[model samples]
Target: MSGLLCYCRGGFEPELAAELGERAAAAGHAGYAVTERGSGFVRFLTPAGDAAGLSRALPWRSLVFARQKLRLLADLDAVDTRDRIAPVLAALQAGAVDGTLAPRFGALLVEHPDSDEARPLAGLARALGNALRPALRKAGLLAAKDDPRRPRLHVCLLAGDHLLLALGDPADSAPWPMGVPRLRLHPDAPSRSALKLEEAFLTLLDDGERARLLRPGMTAADLGAAPGGWTWVLQRAGLQVSSVDNGPLRQHVLDGGGVEHLREDGFRWQPPRPLDWMVCDMVEQPRRVASRMATWFREGWCRQAVFNLKLPMKKRWLETSLCLDIFGREAGLPLELRARQLYHDREEITVLAIPTGR
Candidate 1:
């Protein structure tokens, strides 16, 4: 069926499904979501058979739950084991002729869904991708070499013989496969949680903004910075940091003298003056943390902020929407806010907020 196929974190299919349904309707597309619990994916089927139009209506970065989004081309089931590549090639050729898909693609990504049930297919995906490259190039469907500027073709394996063919536009979709960035923790980092902030900078901000805003010598504050994981990231980025928490930090983090640890409660502490950035990862209720974050912006304490909201609630999407609404309205300013459930995050979402004029 013609629809938008979205990949999300395992066990979050319901949230993603609900988001797709509401978003598609809001974008003036009539569609119903089809998903299985813990399946790690959702399909929003449109009877109008306008998957392309719907995909265009919903931009990838606008989505909170989805890791990757693709326009459905065909769903091939029960394929013969002897020749798995033939059907995919056929689908590509047909779609190209019908104007449903691009005649040429920049890249081909063969990926499995992100779920325990689908993990075993990783090897098969890798093998099939290697096997398909030559045939696709010979058929003139795939480029001889990878091109980052063109659209990508996706072959997502629902099962060994059950394949979902889709197309991804580079301009609108995640650059990484499965929408998960592969980042390694720095050995000098005080804790593994530092990766969360690193990923936030990469995922939340564009290249130009990163270059313009996060220059060396910028000042920042890290609330709840015990053990100094987030504080270390700010320091590594060449920012002098004020680490606020009522606990001790690693001695090495202090050795550089870039970080100043304060023995104070995160919620109670305030920057003495305006700063370039403020980050918090305190374990608190989503609304309380959001309201506190709004205080920072409303009071003109910081120009930009990146924080996390702990979401152990049953209705996560509702909570996410409510908390974001509260943050925006309470801040009482024209702020650009972006949030995502990063791969490193568990039971939480990371948010970045900056004033529009900044």
Candidate 2:
């Protein structure tokens, strides 16, 4: 059986590919890139041990993340295309599907001209709801029977006629207290490029994951936090934040509690004490950021970190590998790390790392 893997552009695909490459080189199994387009599809001839490791590393949470791409459309036609398609469509029409796709994600794709109309593509999206509805109801991915809670689910439609739908996954899970807050990027208007990106990022975060990453009473330091996007997230999470930037921050963020604006160079500024979290969204070269992160991690200046490394326009994969190597070797700290090019992000990759000792 062939195992399918989907990867987001700036996420861990390169690392995953590198891992797969090593496995293939060692005669674990043959691995190849099956399809590459907006998203990527990789196929691996499953080796017992290697497959197990992959399964362990890929938690359901990661599967739900925008960077990791969903693993769906697995050999749907392997046995009998018609046989598989029929049941899925029937389920959709019946509204028996569960999870976020009960309404069906990627149903929009069927409306596009490129897809074959004769293939019952429309029915397939509906079937996802039909087929998974029971499971979702049971697992609480949907509303509980007579439970007055309304939760918003976030769905990611991946490549290969597959879907990755998640409901209330903590990061994007909803029914926020005041309803989801509308963030205004421009002081005068409700819409701006940065605000839109923030909303998109929050939607991808899900409530639970957001809570974990952004906890109350935590102390955070933001490097290169001018105009404060990442800092805004941390402050809203109820963490005390010291924002380091020579540039100005949004007035609202500046007025927020648990927040202190420091007008200093990010690279040169140092926190008075170790912080719970350190976030950076600088525009400098990737190596410079990597070097600084390594120094902080090595010196135990921060317990956990989330930062972005801008990638060169060409040879993105190679560049990612190089940065990973620097962090792994130079940090001189045992670390648990995950990196991905988020949906709300462009031309750069986000890294979330936690020191192992902590």
Candidate 3:
């Protein structure tokens, strides 16, 4: 029943624990150890009941089968450079180097006596990639040269003898790939903040889920609407948005009839009529934002909401718990709520909640 758990972000334990509960499809915790800040090796009760199935289900490349004994494999002095990494390349060729086996988007923990030894590790990864490219093509895990676009696969380089790779099956690929090489890595890319948070948000959204959250002709209020990122998202979904903030929004966002700009204090302002949606990204204490969200829900001022709660300097898990509890107690409505440290966010968690009825 003991296995490893890998999380996003570096050095935040409470956030990782909160993520585990939020991702409730998994099993209970037995014990866990932080391998690195954002990532960890854990021994937990396997939800799958079978060891092999659990191993297959979890993102193992980012996570390793540490079993119940949380031991660190730090015998760097004895490591065989070439031999240690061969099996990992073989797994990548076989298309077995999945996110669970190797995290395609997390950090690797490595220690070298000097920078000289670390150079080989970097060289080895490049050499392995050279070997993997042709093999992946032969396996049909990669697209043929004639294909209009070469599918950009997700990859992670770990410190140990492992290569984490996520093959982008053509049918399931994103409309536009993010995070991988050759794709223009935008400075404002949403999924770049924390891998786990991005994963959680994507996991929560499907075509149906997104459609359910958005409705045509719905009136929306967006707090902290400067530069109009969230408002941009809502307007694209065909909702009419009143973007509220003292700061100016992007001229294009305001030019459209779908969006209106209002220079006002979001906390103090109230809509003349109940809004269909309320979204906020204000930089404030999480509890205050949670209380305000609860008020909107309880007062029937908004039927559904999405907002970001900025976590404190420490104890992020405690803050998330407190916010959730506050909402549950104060909202006084049947609610379906979800929170994740989104890929688009930094030092804050995004929450979505909907009342039971339309």
Better of 1 and 2 by lDDT: 1
Q: Which 10-residue window of candidate 1 scores lowest in summed lDDT?
A: 94-103
Q: Candidate 1, 245: how far from true, in Å? A: 0.3
TM-score of 3: 0.63
Query: Which has the better lDDT: candidate 1, or candidate 3?
Result: 1
- lDDT score, candidate 3: 0.54
Give the CA lDDT, 0 to 100, for residue 260 in model 1.
89
Report backbone clashes per prediction: 0, 28, 15
Write candidate 3's Cα lDDT for 218-258 as tens digits: 89998877777777667766899988899887776777669
Off by over 4 Å in 1: 96-101
What is the C-alpha lDDT profile of model 2 across 1-358, one tens digit per residue?
3333444433334444554455445543554544333333234334332433343344423332223322222232222333443434433344332212344231111111112231344455455445545544554344544233332332222322543322222222123311133454545321232443355346434566566666799898989887777777777668899989988888877777678999999988888899888888888889878888888888878888888888887666677768877987889988867665554456877777775533
Q: Rank candidates by TM-score, best first.
A: 1, 3, 2
What is candidate 1's lDDT per residue for 83-189, written digit by digit as tens?
89999998888873225554688899999888889989999999999999899999998888999887898899999999998888898888888879999998998
Better of 1 and 3 by TM-score: 1
Show pairs that collide, candidate 1: none
Q: In model 1, what lDDT does residue 301 have?
A: 94
- TM-score per candidate: 0.97, 0.63, 0.63
lDDT of each: 0.90, 0.54, 0.54
